[model samples]
Target: MSTSVVENLGPTVQNVPVTEATAAPSALDTGLTLGAVVQTEGTTFTLWAPAAERVELALIADDGSQRNMDLAHTGEFWTGFVPGVGHGQRYGYRVHGPFDPAHGLRFNPSKLLLDPYARAVDGTLDYSSPLIYDSSDGDSAGHVPVGVVVAGSEPPPPISRPVHWGETVIYELHTKGFTKLHPDVPEHQRGTYAGLAHPSVIGYLVDLGITSAELLPIHHFLTEPSIAARGLPNYWGYNSLGYFAPHAPYSSSGSRGEQVAEFKAMVAAFHAAGIEVILDVVYNHTAEGGFDGPTLSFRGIDNRAYYRLGHGGTMYDVTGTGNSVNTAHPQVRRLMMDSLRYWVEEMGVDGFRFDLAVTLIRNERHEVDTVDHPFLAEVAADPVLGRVKLISEPWDIGPFGYQVGNFGTPWSEWNGKFRDSVRDVWRNSSDGVKDLAYRLSGSSDLYGDDGRYPYASINFVTAHDGFTLRDLVSYDHKHNEANHEDNRDGTDDNRSWNCGVEGETDDPAVIALRKRQMANLMSTLILSTGVPMLTAGDECGRTQHGNNNAYCQDSEISWFDWSLPDAWSDHLGLTRRLLALRAAHPVLRQWHYFSGEPVVEGGRKDLSWIAPHGGEMTEADWYDGNLRTLGMFLAGDALRATDAVGNALTDSSFLLALNATAETRQVVVPDASWAPAYEVVLDTSNSMVTEVEAGATVPLAPRCLVLLRAL
Candidate 1:
């Protein structure tokens, strides 16, 4: 059975893939299971390729032997059941169809395509050769990865207690990089899923007081041909090829299906330590890349049905990668939802942090769909996905892509605004406290009216894409010459200050000032009213050596330097202290936005901004550009929350003071009406914790943050 395709893979969806009369069959109609499903008798391989006239499963033996079996075509799906076949078998598919690229049909029988739903994958793309490209019908069997059959598994062990929304603290880290150089991790396990779940790793997280470990992309991904051709590695793993399979190299147990078991065990370990695992997923695009790239999985199966296409059969490129996924496609949506459920139900992962999430909701016309988009709506309605932590990077590189706070209701967004504002303040480049005030208080202007609370803002100063916190204070500009792109690839608009010296200076005073800036940035991130996300080693002086964009450098530039712990104890200690404070104080991690209204009769405002003088801040103070020294007061009694047992939740009110100016500033504590007295709890200036009398003035050093508790 064959079908004529559209002349061009353009914006129009009507004439794409195949006609609507012969579209891919719905699972509800056929009840046909997809992918290689293991049964007691044999393994059945089912694929959805409506346009293909012939479909064959290419089973590869470990010794490079190959066998091809024809799949029985039925209702737009092809099925092949092989008896005596079970888990650990490596296989791919050969789809025979029209080879017209102009009509979005670039099927080549020679290119052995992987199953999009492969539970595990083996081998990497041989990017050194031109034959890897799907340009001709030349054989690509050995060049691309093959799918490994995963065992039919038992239900994963359930998490006893997941962290609640309001009190959750996120620690983002690259799985391999986080433990690659860890002294305590086993030699073999270092830089694998096993390493991330090592006892010392889990113990460190528990000790640091973070409830969630947000791992960077773990999906089976490919090094871009360009990056790989340049002799650089795709360290970030954002170029996703297999969503169901974990990256093979990061598997210590083996990739012939043991990687699945190892990943499940890793998640279980984290759950046992009272920490939830959050995956950074890239569903926006696949590693198949643009028209001139390789045929991995999605491209060979059904090109037009899987990817968004532009005029003249050109691929619609968003996500700053090559191709934007066809989020409007029903089967594509099903695949995503299935992958998500597989991780949560079978693998026992707690949550997912979607990369370039806005692309996931683009409509058939390639426009943003915020209103009841099928994918997001399905996620919100799914009993499994809805309950877990749902976070979005929230934007793509498409038209009108920077929708930071626009992802409404239950979706927490990476607060890029918070990072910018905090960086500006600590670097003393900010115009005033006006924008910083908005960010420090959860960016109410962004999330307040949308029925969202403070937690919706995932406050982060440094993440995988940018400079580490240490480099944020050390590099005045991005030094990405190591990326091999002549330093022109990374963003030049880094709002970083080098603290009177550039890129690792030996001057003690400059180093000290950089440390203070690091502390100030971290302190603001934690003390701010949001879900604070700490970049892995930000608390312990991790530096990319001025390479803001270290996505391709998998060497020491991207890996965490475990040796910094002993050397930078003060910064690490300060981060731990701030996290402890956030865990203990309900007022700090408020679920509700502050109204600034009185909590009780004749009481002070629930929250207030303070002036240099011992008085409430006037409008002029917020607008003044030179007013770097300021204070934020949170009234503990105004939390208006209760425990599960229904008892009223109340605690001591606190004040956070900031001095970003060059000189020491005196910040006066408010009288007893706001707090009985204030005591320094955590000081970025390395000041000792001390009690301050009511209405007393506390000295704040330059580039320092002081958190004071009510006595």
Candidate 2:
């Protein structure tokens, strides 16, 4: 906001002073609102292109006719007021300037740039058209995505989520793929935002006890030319084209500014169902990719200031997407912050999960600035972004990018170590139970030392990018031939194990084992002491046929198959049961990490790891690499927390035993100090819920998880 803040960003023009920056920062980003602002009588277009020699406004009508208008340059921004051009006016910009790629200034009036802050983006880019690139030197109006003017409206006040933070259950889902094949949803509304917000869909999530829906990238994106050439689409929507505009294709309503209203209604519907909407936002990179990529909004507007360019203006990509955004630039950061605020203030969304978030806070030197950075500093000082939830993927391909626990309190990170450790534990490949113990108990090794609590770790065994629950136990290697990249697109470090078979088989034994593995992993995910996130189709049986990299496959491979087959009914029921147990019990969800000591005088420890033979886990048990059996005892009375009504909280104690070895495990119940009696509430072996005798042995099948309640 101040001049010194700009100077502190970096030495390059990427962080130049507001008045001296190549791109217009003082007028457009410093105080003025960027993009199309609809007024009472007309609309005003504002853009940042301080290096441009000339700028013109192209207003396109419904019939495809356009009228040219000159924008008055104020030495800081190019703004023009077009009378009678209110909402629903499709438009693009033509900025005439130098086309010096060496210095990162690639402005070509031939390329019609979409507004960097476009509130509504309509239509798709004709990637095959040569005029869309700077090489053509011809008009690119019809071949590019046009921004539609949207009149701002007041969104309803956000509904308060009744669930506690500790009880949060995040369901990561695709906006369209979630309801694509729902048998109950109407045919017309299927696979659209309207379908996702249908009462049927909302009721399904409510019955399953989901607290939030983390939708993947509703931001408008473009299908990469390479993918398009292969007759494929970017189904994951990671290549962001418009940050403010909701992905138009996902809207059942029209895309001519109607997507905005439809998206708002969807949010309102989810909120009324007591489900918070958290967007899986991609702000680390733009669809305008590498140096040889197409001339999109940022590149044609101000390439040097909008992207992290290296020597000779080469794009510095850390997202593995060819180009990374220049958040170091004051205006670029403002664009990102503005998009975030707009989503919160206008869209009625609850939070965001920033994809490849570390790229957003990197300095001009392309190094991560963990402390005193402008991005985090602004987020902390802002009123809007402070209260809303902020999650980070927390890693990139850049140097020291694996900053899992580096982000301080008030932010949650996707726990990569938790996923790896849990996978290893279930696959019977873990060296010892030490890592699994830490992960199951909220990963205190990663988040404890920071000023954050147990909830800082967003624990998940399977996310959108990896194998689904069913596939995790059905495939040993990736079968990604459908991706068409010689099976080299997705990550090869998938810690999956085929249950005695490589692919789908008719053997009932292997099928049974696979389903049981899914149940076991789901149980572990829900019972863990952190915010649990479930991939969209994981609850039921959803398989990508070993295609872990289904980002380009929008067909049946990625959509949620809602038909509950006979094989997955048990697993789905178990998932619901696990979530219900989590919600009903207070000890299962703790605000703070377990102290492993008595919270009150003469009480059992809050948490204790027990050996199969009984009593505390000894050092020798931990030193054994083959020791895969683990028992965790949670004492209800030892928790130092209170209910929402401020009453001291107490709950029934629980004991969970997991065995991942070849031989079955028989865990002896602890002494009277832990629990007087125990009952089998859930078991992965046979879905049995029965009572166990006092101080009796609980039989756990190999690679099975059993949870019991202390009586």
Candidate 3:
């Protein structure tokens, strides 16, 4: 008789009815193992313990009762199943192993270890002596074997829905700071996952014309001991604890699975509104710091396999977080790749923005490989991940960290040069116009012949890490005293200038100049050729009270104030108009690099640089720092058109004039074969012109940018 037949019988009844006459199974079901049952049911668990001699599973109940289950091995995998124990059950594992730090193996079975496959972790980790091995004792060289089980439970199913890429405008935001002060969200839901998915929150994103919300890390993360002691939390969640589990602190509901469900619901609601969801992933390092740091998941599991260690088993501090991940190791590389795929396939994410991406491509010697790194090739070749948008921060704290345009083809990098150049041209002295011109034209000099398009440069003047657009024009220096760092922290060279006053004042002229500067920055960003990323609150003129580095402020200092004044409302209107203008014109968002020649036969040049007098630019004009006035004539018909073979293409003609001097300048309309008439489509001079006649000498206001169309 088969043991399966006997196990099928209930505990209350010894003999059950058997229809088949071929067999009569015994009551004792010793042959049917729990591991075999779990394997048959398509569920399995895996743990890495290179130092462990034995491992066991301990199941805990809500009423403090416990059940011990011995694990059965299948290769390196030790797995088992409790017939009635599944998804929502609370369980943990214990490993009996050595504590030889000199050999890089520190394991204490006395610690109740978290399952690496756990979808969610219940409560916060409590630091205790039982979690560590005493180095003073003789047994310290070899940790004693013991195990403790803790209570935990998973939540119910989530509402699943996935959105695609290409149509997504991701809004990167921190979970707590995003809705911590939102008046519409319930007090309990504030700063939680539930609040992020609330109808009002979703409505705000929809109103902003954004198609995707790229959230900062929500994974279980460790708060640095020093930061905790200073009464500050980790504002930027670069420190990760568990990859599969969601952070319990971000959950409004107490259930572990509820966090997962709420996160999925957030994606679903955004999808229903024709939006996508991308995640800003930090896989460069774990929360485990150097020698003095706590024993966490990766450190306790298989430190050698997970981390890049130095000579004599010392931790390598490449990520600036005490320890860097060994992506060169095949197993470590597999872990990262699997984590990314899991989020895309299971959680329905549209894309990923890799933090400190250069560190992930480091070779065996810990040197970053820009051209042919194994991890980079793996991600690019992946079928499930290939279609998704891959954005790289492209730099790290290591040597040769500035890799703005160094990433390979098919990867878009955060263009820091574009940000700094544009800011310097508008806010700094007049020595940056030449570099600004290079950035405005898709940064072709940086990404010219790499088989990459203009969009490969993700251009922006402001991001979450620096000043808001309002602060960029309102203050000259970073005021980080509110961060409790005595204002010594953050970047000293902000490249910002207060038109006249240092801070806010009742001076009408200063206020007007600041507003105009805001307009100038927005116009430059939108009109430039690249993928433009607007910081969420910048459009509405949100400020951080001059806090450039508000990493710890969870108060109103970080949240976006919804009730903006009428003046700010007007600015928002202008921002929308600029975006619409960018979307309306193909010349502004060209895919290919400017050819410099006439795009159309018998037509004007694809692009022509001119002086303020409307004459062709001289070599001397390009070198002069004081010559800030210029005109760019774009030939619309000169744009190349493609056929079925994907050849080069062309399009109509357009003209733009810019003047940064203290007085207005007369711009001449150049003679072209396309037409004799030119019409003004947009004029920042008056901010009210719909259209103007061509071939007319227009008086461009000081520090103004104007757009014209050929009729």
Candidate 4:
């Protein structure tokens, strides 16, 4: 997700001497590293622009006085070392080359280009700046923001993710939205990186029982021209500019160089709390959108090498956000890889969730290929990054891009099937039982054949791009008029049910139904056999007033409401209970796909599907479109685990009975042979404790799920 507010353009960077800046590494190493490197004697600025004839570094002083230094060419890299022009120096590149837009060579010496590897960007982009576009006839000297040179520091010691994939509970949250409404965070620190690491915020996440904070994009991003023109912001932050630099706007420190340190401290804090920090990275496209877009870093540096060019030198818009980053190119691919490693090694981030990841694996011909994709193979084989969690969105807006089950091993995919199937089943749609079964079983049909474990599927019911859980059951259609696109921006395939009324209602019965449905969705996500991701504020009934696509609604409509009424206490409590139960039970989260075969001699198999009438699901029952109530029996004897000593782990068998119809249903329990006695462990109907016997029929409330344990 993007940030909404436009950060005001700040003062320019002040020059610092080599004595004040950090000393560079004296050990002979690969000099291929890009960006400005500070040294004890001098600072060396490097730029990789094979297409440019000459690249000049423009150093803007404290008084806005500019000095140009001609860079010496070493192979494809243009390098220049200037004594005393060390850290905190405001700088940008001026490339003089052919400016033929039709052939995609958009190099204009008039527009100062940002360093692609800038470690700290000082100011925000002004889209209205005429010089932002090379096609325009002016220079963009004082209008655009400049990159700051920073003396690199030692990276913090790695503290890898502590939780196993099977036990991972991802919480997707926007950095600003998470802390902007926090009651305890200091006002000055709110909505910043420092605020996110606040003790109160950490305490809430710990209490919510999530392993990783899959934060929205925090990279140096730019506000789009269209979004800025409408006086709206791209709060989602998908439009990234600098991959290596953390978005300075999120930093509370006024010093330009301190953003990197603040980001590292935030990651260190999360690591200390045993919470992994997984960045939502967007490498699919740069902020420099279509051909008509601005002459930012990539477009001005080497448009042909950085972006995929179509017929007549047009951009190959696979991501639907203008142009796709040409990962097929070796230099571009290396830039992405280097950025990922830098976050893990330098910033101490534990993992990454790639946005529109399909674009990264797509071939030069715009075809998705995992087999021979060099980038994919390199990431999966890298020593440092390979150990960290790697999650892919697995698709883009391109043709044949809906590759749900196409990702190779060692990479988990966000399970869109789980979201759709769960929504359909809870909405009581036709033939949803089979679909729900597939999802609850960890979508084995998608990951099983590849020899991947259940953890390969990251299951979830709601995420940032869709309606929040509160709105999912409160609206039948997307209410995104607030997005200001005539309600035509977001997707319309929301399989939601509004209970009895659309939007908010004072009707007690409708409110109750909505609560129950939300509870059902939460319970399913927590109990499903995969890595579950809980959207932030879902546990507390956070809402966007039915605005499913609030990507641009950056006001209170997108921020988390900390003032939830006492009526939502049950909802929060229910989510906590479900998560605790999921953690306590090994059967609920299996590492391996259920074999449906005996684990021990003369014992029942690990899993069994039961019809409402108590028998194993038959062919007719599986095909029944009207079927709403079903039971899943997980034999605890077959559920296996290992302790530190590698001893076998055991737990009580569980029987999950689900009823999605709008009326009470009599769900018959399995025979005594399956379990001589049973006790209801969880009831979404009232979050109450009750017991039932084997072979007995129990009245289950509509849109409720009951978890029973074999006694």
State each candidate's clash count.
Answer: 0, 0, 15, 6
Worst 10 residues of 4 by lDDT: 1-10
Candidate 1's error at 153, in angstroms?
1.6
lDDT of 1 by residue, 391-466 (tens): 9998888887888888888699999999898888888888989999989898999989788988999999889888
Q: Estimate each model's TM-score.
A: 0.95, 0.95, 0.84, 0.94
Off by over 4 Å in 2: 1-30, 160-163, 565-567, 687-689
Off by over 4 Å in 4: 1-31, 565-567, 687-689
Give per-residue CA lDDT, model 3, range 304-407, as digits (tens).
Answer: 76787887668877777788888987767766777777677767667788889899988888898988888988898898788667889989988777788888
Which of the two candidates, 3 or 4, achieves a greater TM-score against the reference? 4
Predicted candidate 2 versus true structure: per-residue lDDT over 199-251, tens digit per residue: 98999999999999999999999988889988889999999999999999988
Decide which is better by lDDT, 2 or 3.
Answer: 2
Error of 3 at 519 (Å): 1.4
Q: lDDT per model, in order?
A: 0.85, 0.85, 0.67, 0.84
CA RMSD of each candidate after superposition: 5.0, 5.7, 8.1, 5.5
lDDT of 1 at 244: 90
Clashes of 4: 6
